[model samples]
Target: MPVNLADQLKQQALAQGFAVAGVASTSAGGRMPLRTAALERWLAAGYQADMAWMNNPKRLAVQQLLPGVRSLLAVGLNYYVDQQQGVGVARIARYGWGRDYHRLIEQRLKRLGRWLELQQPDSRWRVCVDTAPLLDKAWAEEAGIGWIGKNGNLISQSHGSWLLLGHLLTTCELTPDAPAIPLCGSCNDCLPACPTGAIAEPFVVDSRRCIAFHSIENRDDTLPLPLHGWVAGCDLCQEVCPWNKHHAKASTDPELQPRNWILQSKPQELKEWDDNQWDEALRSSALRRIKPQMWRRNLGCL
Candidate 1:
């Protein structure tokens, strides 16, 4: 059983629901041949707003997150569905339209890790989704899953931007994939499409102006006036991308489908909900992090 097990592990990942998987090593200071200047420029412009976690230089660097980490195995799961657009109901970002990706991706990674263990008992492994200190998107780009587009989301030639990135660091020295080529080319559609102009440049994103940021991480009882009517996370950028026009819809996972009422909720309707009602509607949703008051703040904006 002295095989290069990364290949088998990746196949298992695809079989387990991941659409794309690749491996790289971890060390410190983010991915080597750093993309720090672009990051620094974005942060210095005060684009991160209250999400101060992005300011941590170490968090911006992969090497610091896992010292002596030799490889990073990156995975992308497609979350798009056929009914991407509809009538009367507010749209949820395809990624969040299902069960929380953190739990979903972790569950699959754990299974894949166990499979790897059976293949190479001596290999050491660690799995990470969004919450980890490591920058999952950067590693995904390095691992060749896709290239980061102008809107700062990884866009695949085949899968477009509706991807959830996950990370796995292992001690084994598997062959790494060449970084994915930038398929975005000269497209600047995301720049003009953003209601708030969050995409400052081809590869830089000003999170402070991002509706997804205001709706998810920025938890103030009221969103800044600049971001209103943002119902949930924003998808204008993704909606306009040519590559996503014919994007494939993934098999549905029950937990990810929105509650009937949630899909049908209106701005005024959600604003009238009491705290208890809010809890019932978003009970197990990633939106729970926004809190009832914050939900009210979002609805009031609409």
Candidate 2:
């Protein structure tokens, strides 16, 4: 029997450490318009904060991102780590506790893209991570990898909201998976759990008030007085979600494991580290993006 290319591709993705994978049609015949409208409203309300790239035209449609695209191959990597930060240590989100996901996931995606090209030599492809202007969570939900939860994170039945998403846009036609239905019915736990009130409403996050946004993306020397203690990204919303409490598990992948310092260092000790010491400590870790100065600033706030 001839092999189904889509199935083979999905198998390859799973072997490459992606916990979940699915394909979605790029024909623009489904919920994309609704997503676009929601995004437009969010941007209009200044919910994206200083992330102006969210307004890029390519984000609205797959065709704009990769011409001749026929299918979207979405994959999820679970980065949940079962560990606790030491007392008086700055809290970092679970996602950033390990190596930078972009670097690790992109390598897997590149391999997948190459394998697809070998199977269909003439097909064009584009691999995208978080840096791209693509609406990855929406595409991931559409592809059936997971559903978007009330906290705006992709929540898998098996992985909860601890997924880091990536996707490939290709010209090769593939079988589209069924879209995932919203599974966060009546679960408003995340909204009230957010310390900064970032989740203004179900499925709507105002980045201006997001701790992750202010800690990681805000370039200002001083963050809001209320947002402190989070040295990197924030996970309070996901931590409070019932799905995570039951479904989230520690990732077995060594590449996603947290660094020793991230899990056990005291904030006061980190604050005393000079530039050279900070660089050595973080090295290739995702928290390196916060910068030495920002690190001190965040620690000072704590």
Candidate 3:
């Protein structure tokens, strides 16, 4: 008997270190309109901050990303590690505590894309990580991998919101999974727990007030005083969520483990390091995304 393509792909994704996998059709129906409307509102409210690319039309429609797209293979990698926080060290988000996930996830996506091409030789595929304009969380939920939580992160009953997401868009027709239903019933822990109050409402995050945005993406020399202590990204919202507290599991992939320096170095220690040392310490690490100058700027606030 011939193997089921979707089943084989799901098994392959698990072999590639993905914790969850699901398929979604590219056809615009169901919740796509509502998701687009929410995005438009978010953009209009200036909640995206300097991320003007959030307005890209390609994000509103999967077909815009790859013409003739028929199905999307969504995969989530668990990057959560149960590590103790250093007493006075600046914090790095769990996702950035290890190797750059874009590199890690994209490599797996490309491999999966190649396998998919072999299964359907005539089909075309595009692998997308964070580099693309696609709404990853929306698609992840649509693909049945998880539900989008009040803090705007995709939450899985088994893996929580500590997932690094990636997708492979292909022209081949595949069975689509039913969308995941919202599971955050009456829980509003993440909203009040956010240090900067970025979660303005359920399922809405105001990036202008987001500590993670300032720590990682904001290029300004100074961050707002309230957004201190976060050297790379913020995990407060995820940390406070009941789902994460109960369901988050430590990742098994060695590539996702935190480097010793990232886990131990204090902000003062990081500030004293020279540029060359910074490069050496954070090489191939996601923390490298926050340039040394930004590190100094973030440290200044602390």
Error of 2 at 255 (Å): 0.4
- Over 1-302, each residue of candidate 1 has an lDDT whose tens digit, in order, gives 44566677778888988888987655443344566666677678888888777777776656566555678789988877665444555555666666677888898898887777777687777788887866667778888888888788888877888888888877667777778888888788888898787787777777777888888777777776454356678888998988787665665756556566655666667678898897777655666677787777776676
Model 3 alpha-carbon miss at residue 4, Å: 2.4
**What TM-score, over all chains together, does every model reach?**
0.91, 0.97, 0.97
Sliding window of 10 residues with minimal summed lDDT for model 2: 223-232
- lDDT by residue for model 3 over 99-135, one digit each (tens)? 8899999999899999988889999999999779999
For all candidates in order, the CA lDDT equals 0.74, 0.88, 0.88
Please provide, for model 2 over 1-302, each residue's C-alpha lDDT reduced to its tens digit, 9 standing for 90 to 100.
12488899999999999999999988876677788889999999999999888989889877888889999899999998777788877788888878889999899999999999999999989999999989898899889989988899999998898899999999999988998888999879999889888999999999999989988888888887455567888888888989899998788899998888888888888888999998898877777788889888888888
Greater lDDT among 1 and 2 belongs to 2
Residue 84, candidate 3: C-alpha displacement in angstroms: 2.2
RMSD of each: 2.3, 1.4, 1.4
